[model samples]
Target: MNHNLFGIIVVFAAAAAWGMSGIFVTLIIDSSGCSSVALAFWRDFTTFCVLLLYTLVTAPHRLTIQKKDILWFLAMGCCLGGFHIFYNKSVMMNGAAVTTVQQAAMPAVVTIAAWYLWKEALTREKIVAMVIIFSGTVMASGLNLFTLERINVTGLMVGFIVPFFYAGWTLCGKNIVNRYGAVPCLAIAFGIAATMLLPLQPFVTQPGFLNCKIILIFSGLIGLSTVGAFTFYMIGLKYVQAGIASILVMSEILFAGVYAWFLLNERLSFVQTIGAIFVIIGVAWLSFKKPDAASE
Candidate 1:
């Protein structure tokens, strides 16, 4: 396949993995009885350990960075940390479906950042695709306006903020990967984020069950999912514009809905099914090849 096609596939696969994240999270919590903050720490710590070994064995040279770049790594790490912290809190408060829908805002944030930071063109087509995707995500999330009583205020506030940190992480990640390569950048970022979160263990609640077998299995699952997702995302980011990439990622909502319906026995309404179709259409439209542009 061509570059664009490959990038689209990689990004969509990453989104699918992320869509399953909520399921794994629920499993780790329900089976292991771990708090969300603790899970966040374990997720990052597991990812950091696996990626570190992979980096060392596969490409140790990529790990080298100038002293000046340390701060950028730290900032990226903080961004990643903030995204996870707020996102887990949102998931706990608002439910995974609603929080994932709220993250649809990442596309808009990415578009604005791409325009201002990278001088990427803001074409009408891109804008329309973003809107379509956002609408589809909202629809796919099965959000009921009538059930306002079920909504948590803190969750809504934190959910709204997640996209900002997510956007920051993606934009900064694109830059870092361009310079230091994806694996090394991800390794360092995960390490720093895990370190930052480790201190919170004192303040956060611990897991009720401390089964070693369960913890190891959950850690492996989370580590594999995170590593694959981040690696694919970085690869796709290399070949695609940040804004369009972000829009394509809205497919996660559809995937998440499907997973919830199957795994959690959650109802998938007709409206949500229609929303999933719209999301697929929008992603395909955005990823479609432009004949004239291709010829140029």
Candidate 2:
């Protein structure tokens, strides 16, 4: 098989694995009665442990970072920790399909932030894409203007915030990722996030929280979705162009919708389905358009 083709396949597999994250969260919450925060903590802690071990054994040099980069790692950790907490909560509140579709606005958010912060030009294509993405996010979230009851206002709000947290990490890790490599940066960030959330863990208050089923669910979440997804996606990036990889990664949203529909019996209205299509189109458009500046 061609190397690029193999990379594409691995990336798609990673996206599919990531798509299953919401299902795992739902199952864990249902089976263990764990709060979103607890789940986020355990997920980060376990993923960190695994990645730390892998890096330590295979490439210990990757783990060495200058002390000056600590702040960047801290910012990444905060963003990552916040992302997991909000993402899990959004899944719990609004279900996976809605949350993932809403999250499709992340590229737009990051683009706008880059324009604002780093003077990256906001091209006509980007502006149009952002408009489409935001509109689609509203629709995908089932936010009907006329029908108040059909709208989950809180869930929509929570879901909307997800992209900002996502963008935060993306921006923060931009340079740091180059400095220390993706896996090590991620491992450190996850470790920091786990440390931050350790105090909030409910192990002391919630008895029998560590059951067989929950442990298995956590294993899948941490092993497959967190570690496996990131590792495979990084490897895929080596073989695939960034633009193509960005477009391909949108498969995560579709995979999430399919998983939610079949596994959780979640259904999208016709309008919501159209909204999801809009998101895909907008993000793909953005991916195809060249950046205004080469530096960007």
Candidate 3:
């Protein structure tokens, strides 16, 4: 198989595995009723273990401090930690389907950021893809947040925080991919993130604040999906062309929807479903286009 094809296949398979996290999270949410803080706290702890082992294997030497990158590491840690915290909160507040849509919008967030910050060219293909994805998202979900009752409004807004942080991680990841190496960078990133969330650990001990089932869910999320999936993404991205690697990763949303439907018994409205399609198509276009092709 072509290296690019192989890499993309790997990244997406990683994505599919990640897609199931929602189902797992939802299972805990419904059965265990985990508080957002507690859920995030436990999740990070699990992530810490995964990253610790990974770094030991790939870049044990990176264990030594790089003082220059401390600030950068802090920022990356904050972005990543913040995303996980708020994403779990979104899951608690608005339900997973809506948050899933917000996550789907990450490519748009990253694309625009790359254009402005990295001086990446926005080629016709990219423009079209983003537009289509945005249109699909809007068509499926509709931009009007007011349409949903007052209750949904907050959830939707919080859900958006997920993408914002994801965009941060994307750029931050790009910066470190060449310098720190993906495994060590991620391991360190998760370590910093874990420290950031440690204060929230108190929430885990209080019975009212959390329960066993929720802890189990959080444990599961951290153990396999969170770190393991990222490990796969970094490893696979190395083998594949960046473009194709990204497109295949869209499988996450697809996986989320399927899992949500069966496990969570959740469904999106017609417009939302349409929006999902648009997001998928738009992101797919982005995958095939090169940096130059996108700029043109």
Candidate 4:
């Protein structure tokens, strides 16, 4: 298979997996009444354990990490963990609309970061696709990007913070994946993410833990889905630029809508349908164009 095509397939698969997270997370929250931090802790911890076991059995050599990479691992892990913490809080405080709108800015941030850190070019096609994708994400989520409500100080801060860390995580993972490959690097990142969330349980209200069967099952799915999503994303990062990868991942919004319709009986609005179409167009434009086609 062509390398870029493979990366496109892999990243789209990751988006699909991540798209299911909302359903699983909703189930856990409904059944367990757990805080988002607690849910994230369980999800990352389970992911770490499963990946660790797999590494030990299939590729123990991948488990080894260089000394210089330790800090990167920690930073990547914290960025991811912080995204969950802040984004969840933003949703709880400001409503999902606000947070989702905030997240739409991620591609732009990532584009600049990738250019600075990795010298990835900010091509015309990429910039246009990013704008379309972000616009579609807002429309698909039934949000008015320009008419967003005023959030309180806490919500506002965390709302912005969520995408900052998410952008950091994406670019950081791009570098880490190039150096250590996907699975082992993910193992280390998730291990650190799980560790970071573990101690925060006290600060947050966590009732579920292992007490609820539905929460347990959903939490397990979150872990496995996370592993699948991040692994595929990192694999794709090896081929795609961080900026393009971020735009591709925006497909998660559309996928989440699909999953919601399938599992939660939620129906998409007409505008949302149009928004989904726009997202498809944006992603396809990026995926099918020649490698140098978007280059300046």
Per-model lDDT:
0.81, 0.74, 0.67, 0.79
Q: Model 4 over residues 1-296: C-alpha lDDT tens digits? A: 88778788888899888777655665666676778797677777778887788878887887788888778888999988888777666766676545766887888999988888767888888889988887788788886555645647677777988889889888888887877778888888889999998888888767455667775656556554688888899999998778888888888887788878887799989998998899899989988877763332
Candidate 1 global CA lDDT score = 0.81
**For residues 193-288, what per-residue lDDT tens digits would candidate 3 score against the true structure?**
878888777655322325676566656676567876877876675664333344456557667667667875978778768777776777666655
TM-score of each: 0.92, 0.80, 0.80, 0.90
Write down the TM-score for model 3. Answer: 0.80
Please list the residue runs of candidate 1 whose C-alpha ends up more than 4 Å from where it truly belongs after superposition. Answer: 289-296
Count clashing residue pairs in model 2.
0
135-207: candidate 2 lDDT, tens digit per residue: 7655665766566564477988998888778777766666476676668878998999999898887553231
- Could you tell me the TM-score of candidate 2? 0.80
**Leading candidate by TM-score:** 1
Pairs that collide in candidate 2 are none
Kindly give the stretch of ten consecutive residues in candidate 4 with the minimal lDDT sum: 287-296
Q: Candidate 4 versus the native: TM-score?
A: 0.90
